[model samples]
Target: MLQYIIKRLLVMVPTLLGVLTITFLVTQFIPGGPVDHMLAQLDGHGARSGADTGESATGGWSYSGRQGIDAAQIEQITALYGFDKPPLTRYWEMLKNYVRFELGDSYYHHQSVASLIQEKLGVTVSLGVWIFFLTYLVSVPLGVAKAVRAGSRFDTVTTLIVLVGYATPGFVLGILLIVLFGGGSFWDIFPLRGLTSDHWHELGWGGKILDYLWHITLPVVASVVSLFAMKTLLTKNMFLEEISRQYVLTARAKGLSERQVLWKHVFRNTLLPLITGFPATFIGAFFTGSLLIETLFSLDGLGLLSYEAINNRDYPVVLGTLYLFTLIGLLIKLLSDIAYLFVDPRIKFTAQES
Candidate 1:
């Protein structure tokens, strides 16, 4: 196992570089640099922009809108943020930078990426834990019921509901939820934004924690609701596969109770496959919440941070967040493989080596 782990860790290097290479190339190709995003945001004020305000028009100490930033300033800005050089040079720089564990300064937040991640860790981690618990508990029961009922009315109804849940994106669901639950006649009842009530600062830690939970419930629910169908379907498929196996049939032939056969022989194995996907599911949750739910609900997580970074053209934050997320995905995939040991020892890693 130690040797296996070492081999896997070794593979992570090239795997990570490949992931980052694609990310860097794709992100750089995205339209709208800092200047464009800044101007666009200012234009969204629904009033006279800098152009209309006669600043750029009269050459009175203003950028030329999208071209507003003069060359010297642009050069200085680029140098300051390490965007002044060719892409290859900057790429090499970034590789060395992160290898040294320096994530660099966020042009958007004006802080180190690590510092920003630390500050926002609370809200993101809180939301992740909540959704993980909620999704796990929910999907398992629903999956078991669907598997048991197979072709019954309950199964048909649930399958259709899962379709609907999958059809709606998390962000849109978040907006709809807010409209119904967060922003209806009782918007204030749920604390529409932030992780806690304003008075939480004055309360005891436990009180503040309870208040935080109350506030995060809606956002977390919206997130989990969007994911319900997905986890359920994955679990259902796993159970289906396990039930068809010969072992399950043998257990049933022994006159064992259906519940006992399903839970003991079936679930123990089926759930291992499910566990392999759990890490990916959690990573996907971070992305699903990134723009829609976090932005609409105003939670200060990586999602909201990334959104602001995008709108502001903060390349450091954008690229840094991208690296962080991609690394997370890869690490979790590794973790999932390790977890397979606990879930099923009969499963041999060497089997896949060929």
Candidate 2:
């Protein structure tokens, strides 16, 4: 197991490098980069200053008496943002910094990318934990019941509901939730935005907890809707498959009760897939499908931050976040495989077979 883990960790180096290379290349080639944005700002400033003083500001005066940026000044700006360096050189430097856990400063936010992520991490983590717990807590039991009562009225009704939920997008659900319960047109039960009330600091500990839950209720529900449908269905299918297996039949034939057969024999086998899936689902809680939900609820999280960073052409934040997320994803994949062994101890990972 230790050898397998070490091997996986070793493999991650190239995987991360490849991801960073592609991301860096894309950012470099994309239009409206940091240089262009800076030039546009400078041009706008020059135009306004020229209008006020009837003279070209600073440098890059055109013969036509128009405001412009000279090549020297442009070079200075480019160098300042490290854009003047060759792409490979810059990529090498970035990799070195990343190896040391240095994400550098955000060009737009004027703070280190790591610091910005740290500030936003708590909200995303809170949402992720709630979503993860709620998804499994509800899904597993519901799925088991549905599997046991397949073809019954309860199963039919639940299948319809699950299908409807699975068909609806999470963001769309968030919008519907806001429209219904966000105090504008209909019943106002939940807060429209934010992860906490304005007076959160003033509240007692228990009050703070309740207030946090209150604010997060709608967002969490919206986020979990689609996940619940998928997980519940997956669980139900896995359980049904296990129940039909010969082991379950034999267990029942050995005089075990239906409950014992279900829980002890079938349920234990059904968990292999679910347990292996936990890592991706839990880590994905931090990012997957969170952008619109965070935006709708005005939750400052990594998803919203990444969206803003991309739109604003904030490459440092974009690349930094990408690198971090990619590394985490790769690590989680390794952990998932390791977890598979725990779920089914019969599995083995020999170097030759692997």
Q: Top model by TM-score, which number?
A: 2
Model 1, 328: alpha-carbon shift in Å? 1.4
Q: For each candidate, what is the lDDT?
A: 0.76, 0.84
In candidate 2, residue 37 scores what lDDT?
66
Clashing pairs in 1: 63-68, 64-68
lDDT of 1 by residue, 191-233 (tens): 6788888788899989987898788877887778777887798
The lowest-lDDT stretch of 10 consecutive residues in candidate 1 is 55-64
Find the candidate with the highest lDDT and give its number.
2
Clashes of each: 2, 0
Off by over 4 Å in 2: 45-67, 351-354
**Residue 117, model 1: Cα distance from true site in angstroms:** 1.5
